[model samples]
Target: MTGNGADRKTALVISAHAADFVWRCGGAIALHQARGYEVTVACLSFGERGESAKLWKQEGMTLEAVKSARRNEAEAAAKALDVHDIRFFDLGDYPLEMDRDAKFRLVDLIRAVQPNFMFSHSRFDPYNTDHMYATQIALETRMIAQAWGHNPSEKVLGAPQLYLFEPHQTEQMGWRPDVFLDISEVWDKKRAAIECMQGQEHLWTYYTNVAENRGNHFRRNSGGMAGGRPARYAEGFETVFPRTVDELG
Candidate 1:
């Protein structure tokens, strides 16, 4: 948000599973990194319990093995996206439950990062409760981080816009995207990052198609059929907080 560009800006992404961020907003992460934002991705769980079907299909895959593989894949994906500050909550998935202490830990991270904006799952997802649960924690932690009485010494959080990335089934989840990001320049980076999630290799091409479709949406919204910027890949987001502007651009 700084115009001078001397100070470093930050953005936080809260992913329910290890591979969620890669599939949902890898382009956004890469694009923001190019824009000089220090993007931090926090995976709430390894998704071993529910999401790692490929790994589980193996003859004798243990929970520890699944967790290790997921962590490694997530680290590699983050690296591909130029994200250096990735954290694994290791909270366990299927039903990601965060206790009071866990919530406080997340709040501490929010205070430390003080991101300009945040990204998480849609508000509601019937197929995946873990995804919705992560967003709930995101909302709670953001509120706690902004509380004056939560911790007197720690820095309080500012009003950072929480953007819900597109869900797997947007229509069913009631996720309406109001903002479209032109990530055509970073599509290669995103595709590379998507490849890092080896456990979910099937999703690689699926998300590529998603980016292509979102690009069409971007062109349509930004002045379609006339003179819209030619974007080949894009990402969509639904803002949770009201954006304040000097004037309507």
Candidate 2:
């Protein structure tokens, strides 16, 4: 509600699974939230089927139980990141799909938030089609939101940059980074959020390593030998649209 205010800056993240946002762009979410931006996360699924291997191994695990556990973890992580809002589509995973009605719901949300910019998964992911499908949903919904005839009464959505977060296997996913965000200040918050994903304990150290590596990249790109922002942690992104700038510097 507050994010819709004309003066407020807002961002939307379309996560394919419960922990995708946590593992991918938690730093960006935390940093931007700290900088007075209301960040909203839309999780397409709890990753109950494919991604809940740890939970499934626990002796007694049902679909509903897994979903509950995953949702709780997601909420905890969102709280750690100070997320303004979090929505769950509960559309199922392993092959996330959305019909016309579901898509319209997302388009409505996009209209309500009217985010300054949006975040989603890389365009292509061979390992996980769900990740790529979520990005497709984001793009389609964004376009639908801009259509004047879709919802004639509501305000037409403005063009917002869709930033694709770094995927797990960059080498195989063909994801290239065109932007690096310095999240040194909110690294602690992002780490705290990452810890909330108790289901995926194995990834705790891996994503931490990712931030550290990206921080090095940030330092190098910021000024290489000349001296850059001494960023201790960072996140990488690939913009789907061109950025309009008044000056190069």
Candidate 3:
């Protein structure tokens, strides 16, 4: 708030579950926060139903216990990146369908935050129905935010940039990321940030591998990996609403 105005340019990361952003766009979030960007993390659910039993067995983790544990973990991770706003929607764990009211709430949040950039999982993720539903929520929220007369209040809230974070889809999902943000400098912070997910049992490693692979892909595109490299370690994103056709075309 002191260094840079939080209201100016904000980033909102909306994930289906507690650890989705940690496993995918942790580095990107850290990088944005380091650059004085206001960051908000919104978890649709605490993933209570999916948390590793082998890890939380010692805590006698129930649904409430798991949700509390995940909240603390998410707070720690967001704090590591200097994120100010961390919210959880608590819309159940596995099934994240958008009942009309839920979509309106999401639209209201988009209108209130007015994030310049948004990060969410792809709609094509087949492994998790929640991810696809979350993506749907993001898309519908974007539409609602921009719909004039329809949402009288949101008419003032202009359309914000939206980016779909990479899903855990290597072969079947067919996700092609069109935007990549260099996060090499924040990689360590990203690793440190994700370690806070105690319920995850070192889930950072999977993302680290993804980052490394993306880094190599970055190198291949830029002709180098480090030292004045064009975005070595990064997170890849696809635009849900394509505003610019110059490059995309």
Please report the candidate that would top lDDT against the real structure.
2
Model 3, 50-164: lDDT tens per residue? 6556445765556677778788888888887677688888887666766888777777777777777788887686788788788788877777777786578443455566777
Residue range with the least summed lDDT across 10 consecutive positions in model 1: 1-10
TM-score of each: 0.97, 0.97, 0.87
Off by over 4 Å in 1: 1-6
Model 1, 20-41: lDDT tens digits are: 9999989999999999899999
Residue-by-residue lDDT tens digits, candidate 2, 90-133: 99998798999999999988998899999999999999999999
- List the lowest-lDDT window of 10 residues for candidate 2: 1-10
Span of ten consecutive residues with least summed lDDT in model 3: 1-10
Full-model lDDT for every candidate: 0.91, 0.93, 0.75
The reply for model 2, stretches above 4 Å from the true place, is: 1-6
Q: Which candidate, 1 or 3, has the higher TM-score?
A: 1
Clashing pairs in 1: none
